[model samples]
Target: MAGQLSTNSTDHAHALARQVRKLRETRGWSREHLAIEAGISLSTLARLESQSVAQPGFFTVGAVAEALNVSLDDLFRSTRTNPGLWSAGYEGRDIDSFVASLLDHGIDMVADVRLTPISRKPGFSKSRLGEALSQAGIQYTHLRALGNPKDNRAPFWDGRVNVGQARFRDILRSAEAQSDLNRLTEQAVQSRVAVLCFEKDEERCHRKVVLDTVRERIVVEVQSLS
Candidate 1:
């Protein structure tokens, strides 16, 4: 019998994520091709492989299953089921819950952008977040150019600078920010990627500002990790 993914009913979303990746690789398709077949973007596929999202949305999960030529039941056949833990939204930032949430949502990567990616709390720092994300089955990348400061200044997105802080759109036009975004966009084309920063709420951070703008220009989805 072909091996079926045990989405049976449990909080072991991480293990299931591995199955998803394995199945994807077995088909010998790149993330971009899988995304196209699944009716999703390359970045979304990347997010699922790297993160342990427990209960991905229907379309995302269904699309992946279809692309892989696997039954949804096979993809989600679970040997374990733990409803209590994954039901609530994320709790305080050991980032345990948030990490789990990303796993559930099929978000596989975090591109850290805190100006100085350190944390007074151990888990909040760049390295720690990377480690935590890795443990949760997600990938992490820290782009210095994506960090705040020069990227956050006026005319951040484009040369057309309006009075006040530069919006996310402005920064993308800067040579440095633009280059970083181009790289990220290419990666996103091949993997699932998110802009990770200190502010859990992307609305307040430049990363989110940048992401919102990216959504406008690309086939992208901005999901909150928290």
Candidate 2:
């Protein structure tokens, strides 16, 4: 019975870590801010969020829950069963908030599917975006082969999204794209990755099709963040 109880406590700690991190991010609070609000040291909060604490004290957990303005039961119940795949767009958000949203969703890697990753948006250009993600401890990979060709982009901006999507499907059939797709598939199996693009709407974005191809190779839970 003691061993079983220990296992349960460990599970609870993992759940609590996820819950606290999510709650903190939802409020746009940083670890330091949450630590100060909870009257705990930053290291303690970091350990909790990192699941390094296998059995955090009851009062400490309660303090964190209170700081996040959530009941302990509500926090525990928010634990997700799967990390899943996430999709995001930088349509109207600045770089900081965009990175924040990715972190909020627990994404450790981002797959950029733009053919020419030169964004007019300030920080979204390939190098800048990659640097920002790295600073946030997230890996960024650009899969140029997954990008829709320029000839195929007009239909997405115009009314014939299906036409654009069909053209992109053809692009995916090529050897280079297939190679990248395989790489992305392998990465998805190992990490929480997000497919990123510029369009706010998933249906219009080629990322939708990119995700479709990924789904063909693996069973993944997909969620789009605005």
Candidate 3:
């Protein structure tokens, strides 16, 4: 099953790569220009064209398709199916595009699991982000208790993800975190929700740990939104 899933995912990536490259060249659009118009990073565009990304996120592919003046179905003509519940990161994305992606996915609420709801990125700081989401008709809640402590985050950043996840599991056992986890689980059952973090890769992000923990208490499907 895993192998089949892997093969299907690869096929989707290759399909998107082929269409993106062909369409971009046909339209005479530079990679940088397309990336700028799509509000995605240059590296992401390059990786897609090179067919090097293992699992490109839905929003990332959609943005590229839209930038090239094509439909998503035209770019990825596949039978791949994914869950509605999602997780997202804004590592190298513009705030507008990030929020737009969430809106496109029909996300009604965002569970911010950042330990400190502060960001160096404009429009990402706690207050501004909440305001922006509110204006966009999306609800935002900062679940600080679910955040991984700074001390435990070093392991993840240092490529010691297992160590970080182990330590974060201990944090998840706390009363406060458990309470918030219950809330998150209940809310997820009621609406489309995505946990927010800073890392582009789910494996490196503590939110993956949080989502895994949430899965233990409830059944839900999760996909990453870039």
Candidate 4:
């Protein structure tokens, strides 16, 4: 009987861990964000999600539940699983339309891959965009390391080289770029993540290069929202 009880307890812990992770992902929250929202130490939330604690304390659980805006009973309920990856550009989109497109496609997070997160368009600057996404309940993260250097991209724009033959793939072979690509893939595995840029067309954007590089490492479904 004791052995059976122990097994059940372990199963419950695992289930709780999965549920917590799913809930966090659904809201596009990083562990740090959730920890802050829950008013708990980051390490405690990490341990709880990792199932290092066989049984979390009531107050700890209550804090998490409150932060997630769900009751204890609701926390245990299963959620719809995340789909693979999606991509979007803000070429002609206003902030409202841009966010609406993301919502239409069930995107939980926006991964900005611009080297310089500035734009002539209103509300597209890094700080403003982040605030807008937060208001829309979508998480926004900027991965500048994945952006193509202007020097490298300039030749293609000047017609010295065809855009199709720009050798952008070579950039992905760099150690730093690979590391950022891996990080983006890990985030996508946890939630519905989209690569964001300003080009209205995927073919014209460096984000496609980043997306293709990621695909070589992991299986992903690609969608373009321009």
> lDDT of candidate 2?
0.79
How many backbone clashes can be found in candidate 1?
32
True-vs-predicted CA distance for residue 151, candidate 4, Å:
2.1
TM-score of each: 0.53, 0.66, 0.63, 0.62
Using lDDT, rank the candidates from best to worst.
2, 3, 4, 1
Q: What is the lDDT of residue 171 in candidate 3?
A: 89
Candidate 2, pairs of clashing residues = none
30 in model 1: Cα distance from truth in Å? 30
Minimum summed lDDT over a 10-residue window in model 1 is located at: 82-91
| Window of ten residues with lowest summed lDDT in model 2 | 1-10
- The true-versus-predicted C-alpha distance at residue 29 of model 4, in Å, is 24
Better of 1 and 3 by lDDT: 3
User: Model 2 compared with the native: what TM-score?
Assistant: 0.66
Q: Candidate 3: count the clashes.
A: 0
Off by over 4 Å in 2: 1-81
Over the stretch 9-120, how does candidate 4's per-residue lDDT look in tens digits? 3445545665676578789999999999999999999888776797888899889999999998777554244556787889888998888777656566688888889999
Model 3 worst lDDT run, 10 consecutive residues: 1-10
| Ten residues in sequence with the least summed lDDT for candidate 4 | 1-10
Q: In model 4, where do residues sit more than 4 Å from their true spots?
A: 1-79, 155-166
lDDT of 1 by residue, 13-97 (tens): 5546656765666678777878888888777777677653556677898888887888888788831322210111122565666
- lDDT score, residue 165, model 4? 35
